[model samples]
Target: MNLFATFEERVAQALRNLQQAGDLPGDLDISRAVVEPPRDPAHGDLATNAAMVLAKPAGTNPRALAEKIAADLASDPRIVAAEVAGPGFINLRLDPAIYRDMLRAVILLGEEYGRGTGQDTRPVNVEYVSANPTGPMHVGHGRGAVFGDALCALLAFAGHDVSREYYINDAGAQVDVLARSAFLRYREALGEEIGEIPEGLYPGDYLVGVGQQLAQTYGPGLHDHTEAEWLPVVRDAAIEAMMAMIRDDLAALDIRHDVFFSERSLMAGGTDAVAATIADLRARDLIYEGRLPRPKGAPDEDWEDREQTLFRATEFGDDVDRPLLKSDGSYTYFAADIAYHRSKFERGFPVMIDVWGADHGGYVKRMQAAVKAITRGEGALDVKLCQMVRLLRDGEQVKMSKRSGEFVTLREVVDEVGSDAVRFMMLYRKNDAPLDFDLVKVREQSKDNPVFYVQYAHARCHSVARQAAEAFPQADLSPENLATRAAASQTAIDPAELELLRRIAQYPRIVEAAAKAHEPHRIAFFVHEIASLLHQFWAKGKDSTHLRFVNQSDEESSLERLALAYAIRCVIASGLRILGVAAPDEMR
Candidate 1:
């Protein structure tokens, strides 16, 4: 049950009542009215600006309209009190029974609590972690990977069918280099004396196994041909090995994509989707042969002033037209990407989200423009750019260099702190904000560590549940049984109980907002908020023994508090599941 949604409908009904009584204009547009938590907790439980939004349109003063709305809302049994404050905003105090009902809903729904009702009628394509197949994923890719995965889970929880996708860059010049690097390894596997890797080739020892695999596939005879003759053969082997390694690396972080689309597939198959996409744009007069302006801010020695193939991205709000083919007569990466997104639209995904790196911020408008022009504005694309993540060890920066092949792999980080820590810390900050991931701090059992703090809140609930079970052995405290117990009882809500339930009640709104904004960091923040409340409430038990969840002195109040504890636990567990973090019963 979404308390905010229910109150919003109530507010709308109040406005309709005003219209029916002829106190307000009948033709007022009130769709913008909303109900949300008040700015200050002391003011009221929830607040709304319905009167302020409609006062001018309804030809009435905001205060007068607010008074009428409040009067109408106070008649409802759920809202015990409603008052106008600060010029027109209405503050509402809900009856304690509403908060109790929310807690009961939590125990009843379990993991499904806070799920929104606005189900997505169509499939959504979430393309993320599209790291090139040229090498292993780095710490930078880790942030985007976790964010994308969590965002996908959030959308799925919000009643959407989400498809997690990874676009592999195997058809570019980088894979050719990968193939050559692997050929050197193959020679080494055949007992040849290969010294240090030459420039322009991968130098990591990770390629040693690729070489051994090539040797087994063709024996010593594989070395009989030139790079031009055997390059394709070697490229296929390198791609296969590298992709396998990438899958294993993703699995280390508990991330697995539904599709690993190869760039080569666009041009390699019987149907050339790239050519077809270009033709589609050309037919619509969006494609043309035009010379691009010389790039500024740097001197280019190889700058060639000539006409080339271009797409009119500016027509759809891009900064400038984009090139689809290079001077070397090869299709640019952007061309292939257009075909990839076009494939998404053809497959019936009207909504598409791309998780890209911060460096690709400038690419968003062009991609959005391409989608608008190609799909004729039927498909919408949102690109979420995640900023760089600075990895720190014990408060000192851990330097990384992919050039020197000394970079830390995603697996190494996950192995060091475990996947739960890695996933939670990665999402502790906004996607567009820089995050400093201190390896030592995330594993700390103290309250300063958010992942541990949240997990501990969940663990505390279980501890209390166990105590309750021991305190009352005859009582059936199963989730189903406790929900029935909660449903049958209606007791006064202690301010402490109200605080916890109100925080947990915000979960559905947070999930809906985060899903719409394409931001999973909000979930991390909300989970931490509820976790903080749980911890504070748990601490209250130390000084006030009467406030403890397990009270051997009184079975009825203890059961009620136990049910409340379980509700908090469910919310934390659900939020952590979406964040891809573990809700540990005990922290090791």
Candidate 2:
């Protein structure tokens, strides 16, 4: 059960009861009120701003309204105490039985405990990791890939119908460069001397295989052709090869997109989707012909002052009107991007999310404006910009990969430390914050390594269960049996054990909040906290044998503690699964 949501409903019901009793104004708005854990755990189990939010509307002071609400809530059997603190916040101390019941629920539900039900099921389109199909994915692309994949999993767990999408950027100048580079490799593959890759071309050895494939398929027929005649054939072949390599890299990290939307397809088949989008906007008066002022710090030759077809971006919320067409009459990149997102709206997705790199921070507002303009304000676009990741070994920076000849490849890192470590460390920080990923720190088998620390907690829980089974061979250690026995036992839970239970109860709230905010790092931070608490409790057991999970002389106490450990294992495993990491049963 969602404990916070349950109390939120109870708080709202209290307000309605006051309205019926002629204490609070019936027309007062209660939607603004919220129930959440207090900033200080010492304050209470839960806190609500119901009275504070409703006071002004009811023509009363907040403190005075809080007193009335507290009195009504104190009568609840589940609430042990309801105190009004500071300026009108109502702090509620729930009965310990409430939390004990939550533990029972956790074991009963297992991994599905925190999963949402009957929430906003809107079709959400999450477009992420749209790397250009010109080369193998770099470390920066891996960061975005993991972040997007985790966010999709979080949304799905929160009960949204999410579509994972990758927008292949094949219709650009970069692919042309790739085709030219592959042609050079093709010549080399056919026994021609093409030494020292020219400037402005990809120098990666990865293209050599593409070249070999071309030679094996078309032989020397394309090598003697003109650049214009061979560019398309080579570009298509090169892009296909690059995408296959990219897919292999993504699979190394266990990320798979539901849709691979091709940007080239937007303008393909002689039907220009970009032009259609522009025309649709023109009919809506959201497009015009205008000239933009020279951008600050732009070189004189780079700044064009000619009138051009532009989108009225400022009308929707962008800083200025954006040009949709260049001087050569070709559509701009933004024009094609606008059509791509419009297609998402047309495909019945009113909620769209784009996960981009930090460099695209400035492009966010214009794209949001376009979505609003095209969807007539019915669609909402949320852009999450993930900052770059700096790879380091010990203290010094890691060198570039010889395979890609530019940056460290994603596959290289995954292959080195395993996908679990790569994925967990990638999500251990906020997407907008610059992360310094230390290669040595991630592989360490200590508390300093969060991924190891968290997974070890799961492994430790299994160890406890095995020990308990050996100590009492006749005991039924199954989840259902343990939960039933735990509920019936009269042994009092220690303070540390109760604290651990409280942390486990907060999982559902964390999942829902992280999903709503589009932040997967929150889950990483949360599971680490659970692991820390479990380790602390285990340490206390070492110091005091009475607190141990498996006590041979006290089978009843052992059964209850085993149930608690089972709950912790389930929660940590569930959280790691969402982050695309594994919760190993045993760590060597």
Candidate 3:
């Protein structure tokens, strides 16, 4: 049960009672009213701003309304005390039995405790990690991959039908360069002494495998063909090989996409989806032939002031109209993107989310505008931009990868520290905030590393269970029996234990909030908080004999604490699953 949501319903019922008694207006909008934990724990167990939100609409004094609401809430036995605090907030003190019941609920639900229950199953299309298929994925791409995967898991946990997608940038100029680079390697494989890799071509050794494959399949045959004849044959082979390598890199982190939509597919098969999208916009008067003014930093000679086909993006909240075609009459990248999103809308996904890199921040508004136009305002698009990750080792900047020769490959980092550390650290910070990933720090076994700490919390829970089992060999120590015993026994009187229970109860609320905000980092922060609390409680047990979890003399008290430990373990494990990190039973 969500304590906050339960209390929110109680507040709403109190407001309805006030409306019936004619003390408040019947038509007041209570949508903005919220119930949450009080900022200061000493104030109360729960707090609400119902009075502050509804006072103006009801034409009543906030304090007076708060007093009325408090009185109504105090009538329920579940709420021990409700008092008006500060200007108009209501702080509620719940009976201890409520928390005990919440703990019981956690035990009974297990790993499914915080998951949403079929409330909203809207089809959402999440497109992320659409990195170019020209090279190995770097650490920057890894950030977006983890963030997107975690966000998808968060949404799915919150009852959304999520489809993970990756848009392949295969039809671009970069892939042509990759083709030429591989062709040079193919000639070298055939004993043609091709010198240094020419400028503007990929120099990475990763493409050497593709060259070997081509040489084995059709050795010396491609050498006799014209540039035009060999270009397509080599480009297709190179793209297939690079994508295989990219998939392998992503697999190391346990990331898998449901769909890999190709940009080339939009114009292939004689459909010209980009042209069709532009025509649809033109019919709606959203497209026109217009000339754009010179860009802010463009030189006069370089700037082309000519009439072009443009989308009226400003009509839907973009800063300026966007061009649909280039000067060479080819579809612009934005046009292809618009078509891709239109396809998403056509496939019945009204809610779309795009995870992009930092450099693509400027592209968000136009793409959102295109979605609005394509769906006729029926669709919503949210773009999450992930900032770059700065790799460091012992406060020193790490060098580039020798394989890619440009940046640190995602596979290299994952191989060095393991996927759990990489995934957890990638989400330790907000997506838009810069993150410093210290190689030395994340590997440390101390509490300094969040992944280790959280995983260790799970391990510690198991250790407690093992100790409890050894102490009471014949007792029923299953989760159900322990929960029943704990529910029947006296409530925990320690302030620290109660605080941990309160944090555990907030998991469902956190999951829902993070899902709605498209911020998976909040989950990372919350699990870390739970880990810190668990570690502090364990440390406390060393000094106080009565606070120990597995008491040898009292099986009843040991069962109660074991139940609590199991609850903590379940929460941490569930959270780690969402983050694509493993919650090990032991660190080693």
Off by over 4 Å in 3: 297-303
Give the number of colliding residue pairs in candidate 3: 0
Per-prediction tally of clashes: 0, 0, 0
Give, for candidate 3, the lowest lDDT window spanning 10 residues.
295-304
lDDT score for residue 159 of model 2: 87
Candidate 2 lDDT over residue span 1-588, tens digit each: 888889999888888999999998888888998998888888878999988888988899999999999999999999999999989999999987777678788899999989987378779999999999999999899999999999999999988999999999988888999999999999999999998999999999999999999999999999789999999999999999999999999999999999999998898889889989999999988888878888777443323798888899999999778988878988788999999999999998999999999999989999999999999999999999999999999989997899999889999888888899989998999999998888888899999999999999999999999999899999888989887876676677788887888788889999999999999999999999999999999999988988999889999888889999999999999999999999999999
Tens digit of lDDT per residue, candidate 3, span 1-588? 888889999999999999999998778787788998899999989999999998988888999999999999999999999999988999999998888888889999999999986476669999999999999999999999999999999999988999999999998888888889999999988988888778888888888888899999998999999989999999999999889988999999999999999999999988888889988999999999888777676453323588988889999998778888878988788889999999999988999999999998888899999999999999999999999999999999987887887888999999999999999999999999999999999999998989999999999999999998899999898888977876787755688889899999899999999999999999999999999999999989899877789889878778889988999999999999999999998778
**Model 1, residue 201: C-alpha shift (Å):** 1.0
Regions more than 4 Å wrong, model 1: 296-304, 400-404, 488-490
What RMSD value applies to candidate 1?
Answer: 1.8
What ordering of candidates by lDDT runs from best to worst?
A: 2, 3, 1
Clashing pairs in 2: none
Model 1, residue 585: what's the lDDT? 78
